[model samples]
Target: MWILISFWVIALAAVIATIKYRKPLLLTVPFFAMLGFLVVQIAMVPMPFWETVRFVFSLR
Candidate 1:
């Protein structure tokens, strides 16, 4: 669960940094990878999007 959250945070940071710096194109790789993984994870969730998000954040 935490790994999933971390993936999102890392992907977001990578995207922002990549945009601001415009040097490290490598960041796009992880951004796309995490985007794919996130889509799969969201698809697998039995509940709705908001509920799944709430559940993920609710973890200790």
Candidate 2:
């Protein structure tokens, strides 16, 4: 949950910085964001795949 919050916070900050500086953060930021998500994925290594799938479905 903290990771999710941090993701949004970082994204918001990145967008603001990009707009203020007139840089190409639109292209570069997503790669880094996806890398952050990949790290979160790696951290969930012990959870069973089926459990994760079921939990995803339960959210709906």
Candidate 3:
């Protein structure tokens, strides 16, 4: 739940940052790229709580 919420929050932040900074593609692209890397890193680590909850409640 928290992870999902945080993901959306980060996405929203990226969008807002892009708009405010007037660098829509430039800002958002790298933000999402780094976010993807962070998610992969998290998956590689041993996070029982988040991993289990994420899998159990996965929407995709």
Best lDDT among the predictions, by candidate number:
1
lDDT of 3 by residue, 1-60 (tens): 876777677777778887888876745665676668677766776667597558746957
Q: Tens digits of per-residue lDDT for model 1 on 1-60? A: 987787778778887888898868848777677778777797699999888878887999
- List lDDT for all candidates, in order: 0.80, 0.74, 0.70
The candidate 3 region of ten consecutive residues with least summed lDDT is: 26-35
Error of 3 at 15 (Å): 0.7
Residue 13 displacement (Å), model 3:
0.3
* Model 1 weakest 10-residue run by lDDT: 26-35
My TM-score estimates for the predictions, one after another, are 0.47, 0.52, 0.45
Cα-based lDDT at residue 27, candidate 2: 46
- The residue-by-residue lDDT of candidate 2 on 1-60, one tens digit each, is 897788788778778888888886564785698787875775586877677756656895
Ranking the candidates on lDDT from highest down gives: 1, 2, 3
Cα displacement (angstroms), candidate 2, residue 34, comes to: 3.1
- lDDT-wise, the better of 1 and 3 is 1
